[model samples]
Target chain A: AQTVTQSQPEMSVQEAETVTLSCTYDTSESDYYLFWYKQPPSRQMILVIRQEAYKQQNATENRFSVNFQKAAKSFSLKISDSQLGDAAMYFCAYRSAFRGGSEKLVFGKGTKLTVNP
Target chain B: EAGVAQSPRYKIIEKRQSVAFWCNPISGHATLYWYQQILGQGPKLLIQFQNNGVVDDSQLPKDRFSAERLKGVDSTLKIQPAKLEDSAVYLCASSLRAPSNTGELFFGEGSRLTVL
Candidate 1:
């Protein structure tokens, strides 16, 4: 079984600044996928960014990026130019690449991010 | 494309009561998922369906929770004799099949269930 861990329980960033949320996972599978999801007060989960374990390069989307260290089993999310809209509960999720059709995400406890004006 | 849709945005029930949640997946999406999200916690997968058939439901509490996707389009999750621990937000999501595909999941605004 794979387990994801988000050590940071709460984080705060000033507007227009940058912040990073840490995540680690335990999985024996060599091929897998890592994702960062954001859940706002609306209770809608939105994809922030994703990283493929095989890829050495990190993934970046707009102001969201991931620092993926496969050897360390670490995948962290970085938000640049943070805005008030970035305030939410962020979650780290893992999925097996081998289980192509039956893949299910395993998520970690979330990190609550607060954006200060 | 229209996103996944869920009904009964909020539901409140007492312990030992029964409650149900409905979900409609996006058009052309072959995979649908149901997740439970407790406050301050990440979403947990409760069930998965592929084209009206069950794919995985290992974490579901079969003794009290049941879910079905009929016609591979719409799904429903039901909990009989709910417990206080059952209080959580139920989220529905849909995606294209194949695990390698990293297509963004479309999620509905979740149904908030409160068991008194």
Candidate 2:
């Protein structure tokens, strides 16, 4: 069984600054996918960024990026030039890539991010 | 493109009552998932369907919860004799492909449930 862990329960970042949310997972599969999702008060979950385990380079989307360390089973999200809209609960998710396997996504307890103005 | 659709945006029921939620996945999406998100926690997978067949439902409480995707297009999740612990937001998501493909899921605005 794969499990995700988000160690930071709450985090705050000043507007125009940067912040990072930490996440770790336990999985024996050699290939998989990692994702960071943002959920606002509306309760809609939105994809922030994604990283493939086979890729050495990190995935970046605008001000969002991920630091994926496969060996350490660590995948962290970094937000640059943070804005008030970035204030939300962030969750880390994982899924296996093995064919004909259980395709359920496992999620970690979220990190509440507060972007201060 | 229209995203995943879920109905009954909010539902309130007493313990031992019954509640049901409906979902319509995006057109051409073959994979659909139902997740439960308790307040202050991440979404947990309750069931997964590939077309009309269930791919995974290990986390679902079969004794009280039941879900079905008929015609491989629309889905419904029902809880009978609901409990306080079943009070959570039910989220429906869809994806174009399955395992071994890019992991991207489009989620619908969840249906919030309040069990008294």
Candidate 3:
């Protein structure tokens, strides 16, 4: 069984600043995928960024990026030039890539981010 | 492209009552998922379907919960004799088949349930 953990329950960042949310996971599989999703008050979950387990380079999308350390099983999300719209609950998810395996996504608790103006 | 669709944006029911939710996945998407999200927590997988067949239901409380996807396009999740713990937002999501595409899933605005 694979489990994801988000240690930070709440985080705050000033507008125009940067912040990071930490996440770790335990998995026996060597190949998998990691993702960060944002859930606003609307309750719609939106993808933020994704990182492949085999990739050494981190994944970046606009102001969102991930610091993926495979050896440590750590995948952290970084938000730069934070804005008020970034205030939301962020979830870290994992899925296995093995063929004919369970593809159910395992998610961490969440980190509620507040961006102050 | 139209995203996944879920009905009954909000539902309220008493304990021991029955409730159901409907979902329509994106066109051409072969995989569908149902997730339960408690307040202040992440979404938990309740069931996963691949083309009208269940791929995973290990975490689902089968004794009270039931879900089905017919014709590999539409899905429904039902809870009989609901409990207070069943109060949570139910999210529906869809994605392309795995191994052929990334594991990214498109989610619908969840259906909120309030069990009294």
Question: For candidate 3, lDDT tens digit of each residue in A1-117?
Answer: 899999999999999999999999999999999999999887689999999999999999999999999999999999999999999999999999898997778999999999999
The fraction of correct interface contacts reproduced by each prediction comes to: 0.72, 0.82, 0.85
Ranking by DockQ: 3, 2, 1
Better of 1 and 3 by TM-score: 3
- Candidate 2's C-alpha runs over 4 A off are B99-101
lDDT of 1 by residue, A34-89 (tens): 99999888767888998888889999999999899999999999999999999999
> DockQ of candidate 3?
0.84
How displaced is residue B96 in candidate 1, in Å? 0.7
Query: Interface Cα RMSD for candidate 2?
Result: 1.2
Candidate 2 chain B weakest ten by summed lDDT: B96-105
For each of the candidates, give the backbone clash count: 0, 0, 0
Per-prediction interface RMSD? 1.8, 1.2, 1.0
Q: Quickly count the clashes in candidate 1.
A: 0
B54 in model 3: Cα distance from truth in Å? 0.8
List DockQ, one per candidate, in order: 0.70, 0.80, 0.84
- The deviation in Å at residue B18 for candidate 2 is 0.5
Residue-wise lDDT of candidate 3 within B1-116, one digit each (tens)?
89889999999999999999999999999999999999888899999999999999988999999999989999999999899999999999999996667889999998999999
- Better model by lDDT: candidate 1 vs candidate 3: 3
